[model samples]
Target: MADPRPATPTDLPLIIVAIATCLALVVFTAPLTTLDAMTDALGLSPGAQAWIMSGMPLGAACGLLTAGALGDTLGRRRTFVAGLWLTAASSVAAALSVNGLMLIVMRVVQGLGSAGIMACGLGLLGQVYDGQARRRAAAVWAAALGAGVAVGPLIASGLLAVSGWTATHWAVAAVSAALAVMAMSRLPESDRTGDRVDIGGSVLLIAGLACLMSALIEVRVGSTGLVTALLIGAVVLLGLFWRIERRTGNPILALELFRYPDFSGATLAAFASGAGVLALMSMVPTALVRGMGQSPMSAAVILLAWSGVTVVAALASGRLPERLTPRQRVIGAIAGCGVGQALMLAAGTGTSWAVVLPGLLIAGVSNGILNASLGHEAVQTVPPERAAMGSAANNTARYLGSALGIALISVLIAQKSGAGTDFFDAWHAAVIASTAFSVLGVLAMLVVSRPRGVVR
Candidate 1:
């Protein structure tokens, strides 16, 4: 069949998508370094603090699939522009929040906005570029993801030093507003399916994800009964969503896509990337601050060793020999992350931060490769019209995995610390568990990507 992609023009679309994606991530992670200040200023309880941190991911998890479907159906440019505006408004609301609950709600709204940008922005790129150009564009998108993570904390910390936690939100709001204006003016409209939006499926899926993510976030603090009920609700809601999708003429997410090995492998790899390396890295600053007495800004800088390297690695991944398939790159990178995480076993209370530097750097490279490969597979493995849905599914898995990973790691650490184990010792256990998640991901990807006729 003849290719449908347009001839390459100016790189304006790629540049816009990259910046929007990066900005979305920046908003997502801006609270990481400023958590203490936020907690103090908002008078947050532990539970409220947890919500503040988890709200955005929870919102993203709920909204990504729906946003993708909308983008593909309505118009990618329209959806993307709406997302930017939503993010901007939400940021301003968040900046003005007078309490933890308000802030958490605004953060979730921001996540919803980010979901539109993430899924549709990549989808737009997929529509604009094909073949080698597509590959390189995906690499740049992946690098932008890493770059945002690397810079978010630094920006937050710098702003906090000068003004306060709210300043970070104001800064994000301003940037988001500017991007919204730019996107509306410069971005091209993509072809749309003009199908009816799956209202039933969207509602059910969003509710189910909300229940599931909320359960995960509350696992550390909520009563056991509450968590169990939430889980049950999630299961029931999701099961109904599945049935609805099966019967509906226009489903939000086409389940048949899972039959594609590349798509399935990419999804699993994204989950593993989140549950393993991303989850572990999220906790690094905490371990450094509480266990090693490092200042918040110091910890953020230390983390740059991993996140900064990831940007470089992601950009370089597009240059890898074509003989190496995306599946091979994902599996190898995940395994590499496992090995790098294992290297952190030597860390101890008395050790310098430099002890984990090698492991961080190795994991950084692995993460970079994994990100680029997943981004490519996300758009490549799916039908051209459903590019946004593919990106949504990949990212939904990632955020869900991260939530579960963070909850599990927190439980393990709490258990060990409560039992009088040293903080560093508890951290060691988390490292081991996270590495195990990576190994499991590698195994899962292998099975998913196995040769068609080859049986174990």
Candidate 2:
């Protein structure tokens, strides 16, 4: 067969990145509606409710480590197909869920599938593309996924306007199904190999993470006993995982990887980037709707603005990595977003959506740049044989950041977002927090630079 076009997934990097965006689009939009209505429908207390809400991130974290390692070993196509199918199935099940617990269970499954796509996709991409092409592909994928996420709310609002909220899941499920079929036919297989799937370590990791997530999601929800117990259990399980992985010949995470400061710094920077942006993605639009008394569609329109800027930024990211030093680009992106978030906070306080929108635009652009820039840094740090592990580690930082993002924002909103709460005030607080995260991201970049020598 003639070699496929540059953009085709017959090139594994292209295919996996395409699949990642599709998968990300499906559920990310669902949250916009569900978070508002879910507690009422689930009949669960507020704290207990976000458990299912947070479960998506938790599940992804659990599935990513194992999926990345095995994708290299078993075949990326095999895992990609399986993960897409499973994600589609879970979406259908989620649409039919009657209670909070049932939906959480289904969401966990959905997350598991998402993790596979995310972990396997990056690893496969690492193997399929060379230096500059890989960076470009990563940037394009980041841009595409940002677009999908941006489109989700607009699509969800329209679906909810005509049909029930549950119908939206069906719509998302259909998308996943369509992507799965395309994936089976088109996605190129991974070229590298790795150790066997670490079943034991996988279980421990999941259990530990589940416990930790559960503890955090409930800590402020009035469950001191259960939350405390779950946290202790999580700590023990994670400790066990560390000990086991250290002794095992093939561990899920290679400890040696962290010894390289660039890998570690890039991962840390990625994590902070995820936290700041993901949290903003969730809270900012809601603030516009509830605090400012804007229409749902209006709120979504603002989000579209956030998404729009990201696309422009991502396309430009391939150039930044090539044109600027990694440290310069990484630190600049973080600090730039920090300035944006600070403006976002200041504007959100009064009539700043109009003003704050600019900040969000900058923030989105930074995010686009970072996601691609970080991936490039990650793939370069490790040997070709260990690329999947590196990919998994890279994604793990992003997911871990996302988990923290959800938790931090949830706590902030819950604590401050009562009936008496000033809509814009809470919005301001959230933006300030986002700004703080961006500052920390800057710190991460600066700290790393002092030791490594300035990229400039």
Candidate 3:
């Protein structure tokens, strides 16, 4: 069929992208709420569990590095459909895994699929909408993305309560399969660019990230020599990757984007946003179930306040004055996150979820605002030709932060509460560590030196 009438915010194409992106993003955290049950069933140690949680985001960071090139080489629609199918297959495989390691590996593959969908889904939206219409569409997309992060645990908890931990994976598989069919029937294909692929850079980045995360996770097990070796390897590989990007034509990542202060600041804010928000999401269920002795359904209901407010705030952030400088918006939003996390820190072990409600509400709203501002700033800071790379870089930072954050939180909690220490005390310390990341992000933004001719 000749392409449908001009794309609008409510068009079927945009709707499809929104839903796919939401599902893909949700996969990052859906397993968290159900993790306690999953661990029991799979015979997972704490170290194994942390790796399982970190695996998907690390895989996603790798996928973001190269998914753009894959989209440019393969037709976008083809890549999207393939990604959905891959998600379906991996989710099913995850559901069937009999061991912790197998489940972790499958989750990584699932994340790879998720990354492909997220990268291309946005690209599709950009291609379809422009001008003010594009702005509205982008706002809707950002809201959906935040909604995914906020509500993923509730969905996971509900599924686990009804049909056990495997239900979550099976449900994801079913949804992805259905989306794949929808894409085949209704989605329009974007033209292919066949740009020179950046295979070497992509490989180096993935290997470096994997080694780094593996070192972090293994550190929890007190594997000193292995951790040292892995950490050194990671640094060497990442250093080489940076050197390669500086020299190569058609680099996977353009190093020049960092020269713009707004771009650098916004990217760092995005990273901290991901680390603080997602680490909280991943750990809350553990606190409720393992620390406080609550059921998954009850945990979900308690978290409802956090997720609901986030959705509302995310949509509201889009309505703020367009004249607000990206720097101002990002600085305010990240600072708010710091304040909110500090409030959460005050809610100690004996306090009920109600005691933490105010903090969650504040943090949720700030997260929404940060999400919108970072996305807008990331785009505005880059030249039009570099927009795709900018988005990829922003997401890469976010996912990488998430992986690192989860690993760090796990290690900190373990180290703080060794044999004989209270679990809740350790949990409190971990929360503080996440709060520190928000402060660090704020400080990084404060020091960002904007380039000449750039808007503050």
Expressed as tens digits, the lDDT of each residue in 1-456 for candidate 3 is: 112368653587777877887887678878667878989898999778877877787778877757755665565678778889999999999999999989999988988898778767766666677765565556566777867766777788778889999998898899999989988878777776667777899899889988887886787774789999999999999999999999887777788878888788888887887787657655675566666667776766666566666666666775677676557767788888777777766555566667667777787788777776676665667765555566677888888787678777777666555322377677777888888888888888889835233232
lDDT of 2 at 247: 80
Clashing pairs in 3: none
Compared with the true structure, the alpha-carbon lDDT of candidate 1 equals 0.88
Error of 1 at 340 (Å): 1.2
TM-score between model 3 and native: 0.89
Model 1 regions lying over 4 Å from their true place: 1-9, 418-421, 450-456
Instruction: Show model 2 residue runs off by greater than 4 Å.
Output: 1-16, 35-48, 191-194, 348-352, 418-427, 449-456
| lDDT tens per residue, model 2, 18-41 | 656655655756666656666766
TM-score of each: 0.95, 0.89, 0.89
* Overall local distance difference test of candidate 2: 0.71
Per-candidate Cα lDDT values, in order, are 0.88, 0.71, 0.75
Give the Å shift of residue 127 in candidate 2: 2.2
Error of 2 at 367 (Å): 1.3
